[model samples]
Target: MRLTELPRTTSFRLALMFLALFGTCSLLLFAFVYWQTVGYMRRDQDEFLQRQLTFYSTLSPADRVQRLREHPRNDPGTRRPSGEFAANGQWLVGNLSVLPAELRQAHQPVDFVLPSAGAPVPFRGYATQLPDGHWLAVSQNVHEPREFEALLLRAMLSAGLLTLLFGLAGAVALGASSMRRIDAITLAIRRIVNGALTERLPVQGGSDDLNRLTREVNGMLDDLERLVHEVKGVCDGIAHDLRTPLTRVLGGLERAQRRASTVEEFRDAAARATEEIAALLKTFNALLRISELEAGARRAGFSDVALAQVLADVVDLYQPLAEEKNLTLQLSGTASPTDITLWGDASLLFDACANLIDNAIKFVPAGGHIEVRLDAEHRAISVTDNGPGIPASERKAVLNRFHRNEPSRSTPGNGLGLSLVAVIAHLHDMKIDITDAAPGCRVSLSWSAR
Candidate 1:
């Protein structure tokens, strides 16, 4: 904004550079015009002087002498001076009282100093022999053209100065505006870097390049805020879930050490303690797997995988488990494996779909209906069950680490099945949607090849 800072901006520097280029071009153009104009004026003067001498030479000596008697200098428009003198360099009968020293030995057009103005002046003249054996001289005035040249020079100089002033003012205004915007962006980013997660850059609602950059930066901030919240939730869940199990294990071990007297009593406590420890390890491993998937490394090994085949395999893997639980498991979709092919990591997709089916079978009541449907035409796979469906408010929450609905708390799970499925779906550029299926829930994962 200050004069000292203006020179440091790119806009100001570019303005100055363009102005210099334009000024140089203007100067060269004026110089050329001046030179050509002067040359033309001098040529016209020489022609006028030669014409006067030729016209006078055609006259008789008496007429020539009579013409010389006229005071030619008295006519301002033609300042042509005429003179005749005995070849003795004496005073002549003309407005030019004396011949310039530089012109004494030559008949060419020349310039001489004016004693009245004390300045050099231009004139073109001719010297010729008269019939009386004397010298005759005539000159054409050149001052008018020279005066015109001076006036042109002054006009151009004033206009150039004005143009320079206006251009500089405009450049300064533009540079200041640009610098102010840049300064604002810098300050906003600094605040964000200082842990102000909710802070956002301002958008002017224009399609300028800087506005687009600001929008992109704001988008990144939004993602950062979401990710920070997710991490915080995961940490809190870890501390809360692991603490109870860990305390129970410690209490069981302590009891065995102090009260157990027989080997059978010690064995029972040890088995219970081992089960709690196994659960802790399982929770840790599931968290690690979700982190790995979200980190986006699994997609690197993606290949063409048929969704129908994955569904069938999931149904097969969980059928026996469903039978043991007395739940009716059914696979109803494309019978052929070649119906719908998806571009993704096959193993990851298999695992994700397996979790979905497993989740459905676990929650469904005895003899309840469980179905895996694959829509080859739409490239969608959904798992539905007649279990206590998740509430609309809790559907989204169930996709987070260790987030369990009230109905799922009694089930033997760490609340990471759907979370892992969400991670895998994201890595494959897929979308996971959960909706109420009448008396139960329907979970569907859909995607395109790209």
Candidate 2:
């Protein structure tokens, strides 16, 4: 960021705007003070003149003349002076030499300048016509008030200049700070674009608006990085998982073409190939279903669903398989089936619960007890199996697509069952918890009732 670009920044521009507003207000305040001060000084001077005029008016003519003649001697400074003048404009007695032509009205205050030594001195005064047709004027020299006005103006100007300097400095500082943060963010974004997936925006640790925005962007970057890694993992999983089935299908077909002379033998080979193809198709379909669920494509199909009913249905669907494996499958809950309900897609919820029960049947040993438990108050359903439970470390990994536990490698599955369940739970705004069932594993899905 260059100095030339500083003014273009929003922070700098706003600072300048506020500074201008403050300067304007200060100027108005100074003007008002100046006006009031000058008016008060002028009024005070005029009042003094009026008081002098009244004192002279109460005196006899002889005494008035004596006081007027003695005024310059009694007040050697001559800051305030009185004078008597004839109607013809001739100065009679006092410090003043002649009647001011500016004082045309009687008993009215006026401002005029008189030659004092070699300089012209400003005065405020009032003149009154006596019965003898002579003018008596009382005045005060206003050099101090005028000097005070000039001093006040200079002080105001100095203060204004200082304020402007400081304000400009502050604005520049603020603009520079903003520019630095923006530059850091831009650099981070460029790094991310250049494939530094872990790059994040800088945080100043302040709770200011800019810092808050940076934190949010960094959080988004964190999510983006996680998604990128997940996508890479998914692609790898697809390639690895599909290669075996596709190879088996191709190898079986080639074997049947080259060596299977008898129809029965050919039919056997064809059947094996068909099975591999079917398994491939099932895996692909499961992947698609998980994708659809993750994208919330089935949200429009959501309706109020009973948790206990879904658990019972899942247990019923998987009970025969559990029995075939010499396992016991039971549906149990603390509340009535009708009472534990939530808003969700019924089919998706059923499929999710079925997946949990199916996984339990697959993993649990012979004569293992599997229970589908529902909690009405928490709007939750849990499937627990008394078999070798999933390892604590692999619990979260099993939720990812195509993730299979080491011990379950020989099991008949594409490894998408729990992933599908996870997607379904997420789509319904439910939380899935995999916990220890004491003797085995417990997988629970819970939601907040709206």
Candidate 3:
């Protein structure tokens, strides 16, 4: 967030490290090029000096002196000069007036300086001792090559400076970007911690790694918000639904204590209170079962279960209830009962199927028809009944605890049957769909291929 902190950021530090590494490599490469170029130029100068000395060696002394005198006149610039000298270091011919001390080594190349009219000039030359005890020296001035080397060094330095500047700027930009995103995320998290359940992390809308991580965190926030709301709703539902049964139990006992005149009257009041207490216990048990299923505790008892057989058993268990209400109950499938199977807890599946059948029997009119259908290829089972269908708007709500339709409020239930079914379906990795069967309601549970 601040300029002083930029260098401490990981992005900036990593960029600086790479820049340092690149700069080191560039320096090494430049040094190699400088070494090779200087070496090549000096080699070229040495070869030229050796060739000139060899030519003079093949000549007579008198002709060699003549050629040396003629060499300076052929090129008036005196860039290349040849001189004949005595063994005592006396300059005898050519434009050179003083023999350099570098000529002390016979038949070897050396570098030395000579004075010009304006400044001192550098030269590379070879000296050889003639058979007559005289000396032959040939040289070439190297001022331009030295200047070229200086120019190359300056250019490399300029390029390296510019690269360093640009690299630092890029590192700062990346660090600043990262810092801004982190600040936004921190602010959002603080807001959420302060009870802003809807707050979410910021996203830049790019497919970069940071953006992808932000999106995932936001999705998790969404789920957390939903769960918090569900927990609050469950608490409210528990308080409201349990209060009625408890009040009835208290009221029935109090009436018996106050006005019951005989043992029979007292027994009736006790029976009524017991029935309400039993219903309250049933509701609590159903809640615990749902919680257990949702926590995946039933998964340990999982095994291959014939779903068709479960449906048959459910139909048989609920057939007498349907008959007592003058309703028709039937079970049919697209495949053999033995062949339609699933991987789940058998008792849970049976309870879920039984709940669906019981609901159809309870709600359907007298003489109404109900069918339990199974589709093996699609791994689905459904119950269709000619009853007043659940409205589409309340379908999802009915799967929550203590949720009952207005028409079914007078029925004898705590409204946990479908909620239990939903938890069972979830434990088995199945989806429940409530759809209209034209004139009635159809509830289906399906699972994908494992």
Better of 1 and 3 by lDDT: 3
Q: Tens digit of lDDT per residue, candidate 3, span 1-450?
A: 688888788888988899899988988887888789888988888888888889988999889889988887886988888888898989899866677888666457887899879899988778878887887788888889878878888888888888889888888898898888888899999999999999999999669988999899999999799778767767776776789779888998999999999999999999999888898899899989998888998898899998877888889898898999999999988856568778999999999999999888888899899999998777899999989989999998888778787543688787789999999999999999999998889999999987
Give me the displacement of residue 250 in model 2, in angstroms. 1.2
Worst 10-residue lDDT window for candidate 1 reads 112-121
Per-residue lDDT of model 2, residues 59-109, tens digit only: 998999899989999878888888989988799989877688877464488
Candidate 3 residue pairs in backbone clash: none
| Candidates ranked by lDDT | 3, 2, 1
Candidate 3 lands at a TM-score of 0.82
Local distance difference test, each candidate: 0.82, 0.86, 0.87
Residue 442 lDDT in candidate 1? 96
C-alpha RMSD (angstroms) for model 1: 5.5
Winner of 1 and 2 under lDDT: 2
* Best candidate according to TM-score: 2
User: Residue by residue across 328-382, what tens digits does model 1's lDDT show?
Assistant: 8888876464657888888999999999988888788898999888876666788
